[model samples]
Target chain A: MAEEMKVIYERPRSWANKVTHYCPGCTHGVAHRLVAELVDEMGLLDKTIAVWPVGCAVLGYEYFTFDSVEAAHGRAPAMATGIKVTNPDNFVFTYQGDGDLASIGMAEIVHAAARGWPITVIFINNGNYGMTGGQMAPTTLLGQKTTTSPLGRTPQTNGFPIRVAEMLAQLDGPAYIARVSLDSPVNIRKAKSAMRKAFNAQVRGIGFSMVECLSTCPTNWKLTPVESMERIRKEVMPYFPLGEFKVAQGVL
Target chain B: MSDKVLMKGAEALAEGAIQAGCRFYFGYPITPQNETPEYMSRRLPEVGGRFVQAESEVASINMVYGAACAGVRVMTSSSSPGISLMQEGISYISGSNVPCVVMNAMRGGPGLGNIAPAQADYFQAVKGGGNGDYKRIVLAPSSIQEGVDLFVDAFELADKYRMVVMVIVDGLIGQMMEPVEFKTKVDVSTLKTPEWATVGRHGRDHANVITSLTLDAAGLEKWNLKLQAKYAQVERSESRIEEYQMDDADYAIIAYGTMARIAKTTVRVARAKGIKLGLLRPITVWPFPAKQLQAYAPKLKGALTVELAYRQLFEDVQLALCGKIPLGWFGRGGGVVPGPQEILAAFEEQFGKGR
Candidate 1:
């Protein structure tokens, strides 16, 4: 008789079966997988409308098996609010990069959160603009060298790095605000859990929710995937601490 | 008999949008068009719709884009400078091939020129303001009644063509009060959702993705070809013009929007003086009633173009007439609106005293 075997793991149902365009060691694929997993686990595949930002994940819509719209650079939050408000019963979310959300789209993100629009945001902060090739971003660490900030970022010129999670947490609108890193297996699982909680806030119609994923851009960082993970632990984490910044009442 | 009520142009235009089944309105405040958002803020909730006062015109147009992608009737209104901020979002919406209505209540501008009425944005509206090879159906309304009436056509054309449809009115029309009637009331419940909307998959076999990005050069060229085809179809079928008193006329004045309304008085005055002057008003400025103007070129001895801005409308008139008739141009910029007598005097100066 043939041996009885069962599949232990496989791709998430909501994940599209296609090769990704992300550079090797980039955590955008990981972030996409987490979102896809949540879409499948929560049975929201059919009811999910994603607003993809104009950055590395600009074509993120192609990697997911759900309705999606592409927003102009930095306008994802506003676009997502438009979608959520008009289609109140549908689940809406925005996937953005640090440059897209924390820099050019600052006003959009702040206002969307302040309006308490019940939408989820998955922000991938890799310290620099990845798509445009290693330019300085609003979240670029101090002393980090980017093409735009070749020598190093300085307070007098380039300004200080923005801590978006802590800043948004101060607002009354957001029901949940959390920051997690994708530097390790344990933190990856934690990031997934935090994303679930953020989605729960929206599912329960509490208010706005966001999960900031401190990710890696190996190509831009000029480091191997392993060294990038280590840098997140020793460097990025000190500046952008990981933890839930806000959790509204009744959110698990 | 249709019930008519005295209404401010901006408020009437807002109510017209509501009547056309536009359930979502996103806008930021600006001069000559503030009443639109104010009216929508109060009236949308009553109609089971949504209204958002965005942080800026940039956000407002993006919100309009999002709602439009959800396959719903949505709109935004702004003045000159504010509309400039919306150009990027408008380009994205057009490139993505979604449907939405945008209103520009023209204010003077080279830069924050003034709050007074002006038509300097003619090139921006009928021509290109945003990036890429895109065209928006621009309807120029000469009166509050016409502005209200065009709102229905604006929304319908937007949906029909799956592109942006802009209704351009000057501050004069936007702020002035006139008797208007709500001629058409579209039942929002009857509006069918388009297949391309990104509202959610629901039970569909595949998800819809709305994007304007085509990275491949050949692929983008093919998309451009498709858009050009659609624009050609619109140009063939949608160009509109009103020929006022042109029969047996020796001279004509070509104008649009508020300028057209003021020029109508010039036509009457010139005819009273037996000058045989008439008016050719382009109702749809883009797709530009060029053919209609050409049809009159053979009969007209001279055509004078008048506007609230310098040489903008005259350029299109010149292109249409193509030097077949003696062309004359007159305009006042920086918020200066020429009176009927001044227009008549300019007409005589350009085309001579009488027929």
Candidate 2:
């Protein structure tokens, strides 16, 4: 009898391994896997509660092995803040994209951080909007062509991309803030680690924690899935650098 | 069994929450329902409670969302514009399935219409104000007494169903004070909150998730169906209506919350004028008493709806009547109240033939 070979990079049983509704080559699948991995690694499979955003990955709840909720546009942080505060025992995280986090939800995110609510926020900073037909996001890079930005982003009119990690790093309440990209395996590892660290900080009774992942959107970027991965490394990384933007020393 | 206190329709609602062991109150100051948070601010602090006057309407509702997640009894008050601003947060709470009481002291509006009483926000209160498919259990208070009664009912329904309960009142009803008594005192704080409450993760094994997102069309469908079931259950179990004089009358009026109060006064005046009018006031508009109203539809001549708006709830009365019964309406905007006499005139014009 021939020896059976172990499976390669297939769905992890702990992740429910169901087919995701994502368009080909979307990095949200990768980000979601990393989170499910951490939930399993930390033995939070049954206990983890995730708040999903109202963007491309809105059905993020279906891809996971744990409990999830869909928040209104720009209100993931507020909803997660509620879940974390009310059910302080659960592992709470909000998976939000650029438009949901930076554009409409600016008020909720700022105040949740300012109040030092103990929670974790996973912000996926793709350059343009994804779910609502690729409108320009607050994090849209200069000269990025999107449905809303037909002539590329104009600094004179649309303003520059927002560095959310940098902006949030200055806040006194946020316990951890890291910005990482999902361009390659090595960076994906770093992004995954950043997410674990932020969640672990909240688990330790630390204050608001966030990990900003520079993700990819092939459909919106008008690139193939392969090219989408390539752009993250070749173009996107050059603009949004990878690093640990903030950490509350001795707190975690 | 607690001591009785004289209160306004609005104060009765606030005191009812207090008596029910409510502990958190967050809201923006709008006219009409200002007494709710004002009473909560002073009263909550005295009884180990928390009251926060939020920076804006948005902040206040979100703050309630935050506190409720922590397993506390939380609520907020707002008028029309402020309530509209709170739609985002209210949607969040509904999606999350976090229970909290939202008091809408409705005034006239499309845009800051008036400070006069109006029930124009019928669509907003019943339909999930924010995006996504959901509904709130809208409790309409018809009297100074029912104002207090609905708060207790709201907390019960909010907790029972694990959804947002709107104690929708109008300006005139909220601002007016009257004597009311609790037939029975309920120890609201003693009622055990669900294990899902996120008070603290310490020494716990379960991590609860309270959210409204269902990423896939199928997954979203599952959640929506579940919500519909809950709403159906609410409709079957919690819907309420008050029938003041439907025994021999040909026409009945269908109104709720503050509109019902003005409607009642209109009913009395219209009746005295030899119009055999009876009031069919709905206490809860969301799980609307459609079945009850439909029973009277075949026999009714017409229905008069006295709301605080021009076009707000006229449609609902029409919907309940289902084109089988003709519907008439009367009202004002902002906080301008509908005079009982004006409503009576509209009633006479619309249904005078029956008399």
Candidate 3:
């Protein structure tokens, strides 16, 4: 008997029915899925406005079913601040990369967290600029080598890497700040949990919330997807340090 | 007519914006324009609107882009240096085709020039200071009253074209006080919300996505063409010029903003001396008043571009004339505001050179 297999798992309704443009083995797919699934589960798909930044996720609108806007390079925090302040009833979140949030957009992100704007920030730290072809990002480890840093980054030449979760946690404004990794299934589940907490923090109208996802970029790193996960687990996790930096009362 | 109340130009412009239904104001304080944000901070809360003093001009303009994308009337104000910081954000806003108003209370600058009145930013205002092919509808108001009145028109035109609109004034106008009557009450409910605005779906089939990135060259070309068509329509329907004593004159003085006010007095002085000079004040600087200036070009011997900058507005005057008539230029820069006497001397310089 030819029995039809029942569908146990499927795409979330909040995600578009199309192929994403992410590179092979890129964890942006995983991050996007977590966001879409949570948006659907929380019944915020209709009232959420995702502010995308100028990075690998610049075309995020194509994959999201809800309303989205594109911010200029590194200006997503400021844009999200405007959207959240004007439409207080709507949920606004900014999905940004290390280059977008911690580099040129440093001022915007700092001020947004300092102001305690009730918005969620999903920070993807891949250690290098993924869209611009493997340039050293602000989150690049001290000794990591990139296209721009062929001889490996030095403390004097490249400066110390910014720990965004820890930096933002110092501000009195943010309600929740956490750093999570996606190097394995256990960490992937933990990353999703952190994102859900960040989203709920916005829903509670507590303050700004951010989840720094230690993602992978096999194409930029010149490594296989398996090796990339190994790198995140071995190299990136030690430097980035996974844990909640700040948790507001009742936010989690 | 309503009773005119004494108001500073910046304060009057703020009132005008509020009346035009601008519910969100995000700005960083700069000299000569700080009063605008100060006024907004006090007034917006009364109307259940929001006012944010941003960290920098860069963040301020992005905030305007954010609020504007969510289908609200938003604005930001700054002086020349601060405005330069906002160009990148302005380019993004225009590229994304959002409606908002930016006010520049001009001061002299290639750098941090003094916080005095100057119209040196004419080129930056009209000639797409930011990267990419985009146009901003620029309105230059010479007086406090005119500046106040243009706010209503600026927001209306921004919504009508779904593009950026600027109300440009010099620092003098921003700081000076005058008895102004804001009689026009715009009913914002009558205006249609933009079809593309990102208002979260209460009950809609799809969501609105506002973005400027069109990676495909063909897709980007299509977007550029749409912007060009809309700009062409604006150029045809919204060109504004005020001709003073242009009917019987042998020479025309082309100016705008504070320069136009000085040119008015210059025209009177020159005409009293029977030099047969007239004034062509452009209210809409981007549209350039080219057609009206061309019509009077045949009757004039030559045109003189008198401005606060070295030769910014003169370039536009030359473009409009297209070498049909000889052009003369004179101006002051770096926070120097020329008087009617100084302008009259420049007119004599042009007349002397012609002979």
Candidate 4:
């Protein structure tokens, strides 16, 4: 008989087999994997409807096996709310970038959270507009240089970075709000756990839930993938502290 | 005995939508159309429907987009300025090929001109207001009763073509009250959820994904061509016009919405004064009554286009009967409503004072 070798690990069932358009070592792929894994692990592959934002992840619908819709830039939260309210039994979530969510989509996100629409939001903050070729974003830190901020951002010129999680946690609508990073394997596990709780919040029909992933963008940051991870660990993590900001009772 | 009830135009249109099986309404309050959202807020919940007063017209249309993607009957109402804000979402909905209804209570425009009634958004509605080569089926209702009746056709046409069906009326129609009978009550329970709706995968072999982004040039071109073909079919089959007293008429006055309603009185006035004038009102403005107007070009000496905006409706008449007939134009802007007698005066002035 042949050697009784068995597969130890396999790809998540909810993840599609298509190759992603993300650049090498881009954390968007990592974030996508985490979402797909949770969608599979939580048995939400069939009922989940992903609202893809108008950014690098505009084509995010392709990465998942579940149903999806593409929303206009910064309107993903409103669109996801539309999907959730009309089909209350279906699971709806939006995947957005910092510029898409924290910049142009501020009102939509704020109002959606305030309305307490039971929807999950996976916000990827990399301090720049990655799809539009690295412009300074609302989440861009002071003294960080982007294509739009060649001399480094200053509060006098570019407004200070927004702490989206902390701000959203102030709202009474969100049942869970957390900030996590994808810098290391340990932190990646933590990010995944936070994502699970956020999903669980929606699954339990608690309220609005969000996980702001402090991700890296090697191409936009003009740094090596290793340096990007280090930058998140040293710089991004300080401004956007990693931890749960709001947790409703019984949202484990 | 008739069962018609006296209802405000905005409230009647809302009830018409509910009767037409539209269970999802998302809109922001705007002048001349605020009663629509207010009525929907109370009515939708009573009928086991959903109502969302969005933060802005942008959010409202996006919510409409979202509900439409889930393959349900959804709608939104706004005036000129608010409708301008909705153009982006409308374009996305058109590009994504989802079905929804939108109502525009025409008001003075260019920018927040006034809350008074005007038909300045003709180009914005009948013509392509949003980017790209997309078309919306625009229904111009001239009266409160007609506006209420058109809501049924609006939702039906939206679902039939998977395109946006706009019911356009002047602010007067939105604010006015008239005896209206809800002739059609579309049992919402009979409506089937579309197969393309992004509700969930269920047990399907493939998941449904609704998007308008076609990265490849050839793919986008293909999509555009497909949309153009659908528009061509709509234009060929769906053009609607009402010819009021056109038989043996020496002149015709072409108009729509409130302008056409006044033009009907103008027709009676001009005929009484022996001008033999008739009114040609376009009910479906986008799939414009071009062919109907073209047919009358040979019979009439001339046709005068009247509107609430300067030369907006005339542009379409010019395009349709440019060389075939002598075309005349008369309009007022900035919330000016010309009386029937004034329109008759303009018609006589343009058509050489009594043929």
Which candidate should be chosen as best, given DockQ against the real structure? Answer: 1
Model 4 lDDT tens row, B2-32: 3899999999999999988999999998999
Clashes of 3: 0
Q: What is the lDDT of residue A99 in candidate 1?
A: 96
What TM-score fits each model? 0.99, 0.81, 0.97, 0.99
What are the runs in model 4 whose C-alpha is more than 4 Å off?
A1-8
Q: What is the C-alpha local distance difference test score of candidate 4? A: 0.93
lDDT of 2 by residue, B1-355 (tens): 4455677777778878876667777777888788888888788878777676665787678767766665567788899899999998887787777889888888877787777777778888876567777789888877777767667778878888888988888877777777788655566556675687644334455444555554579987887788889988988888788997789888877666666666778778767777788888888888888888889888888887776666667766677776788777766655576667877777778777456
With candidate 4 superimposed using the best TM-score fit, by how many Å does residue B270's alpha carbon deviate from the native? Answer: 1.3
TM-score of candidate 3 on Cα atoms, chains taken together: 0.97
**Candidate 4 chain B worst ten-residue window by lDDT:** B345-354
> In candidate 1, how many Å is residue B13 off?
0.7
Off by over 4 Å in 3: A1-8, B189-192, B352-355
Q: Give the DockQ-based CAPRI class for model 4.
A: high
- iRMSD, per candidate, in listed order: 0.5, 4.5, 0.8, 0.5
State the DockQ of every prediction: 0.92, 0.23, 0.82, 0.91
Task: Quote the B-chain TM-score, candidate 3.
Answer: 0.97
In model 3, what lDDT does residue A48 have?
92
Local accuracy by lDDT, each model: 0.94, 0.78, 0.91, 0.93
RMSD to native for every prediction? Answer: 1.1, 4.9, 1.8, 1.3
* lDDT head-to-head 3 vs 4, winner: 4
Chain A TM-score for candidate 2 is 0.93
Give the deviation of candidate 3 from the true structure as CA RMSD.
Answer: 1.8
lDDT of 1 by residue, B148-219 (tens): 889999999999999999999978998889999999999989999999999899999999999999999999
Provide the fnat value for model 1, as a fraction from 0 to 1: 0.90
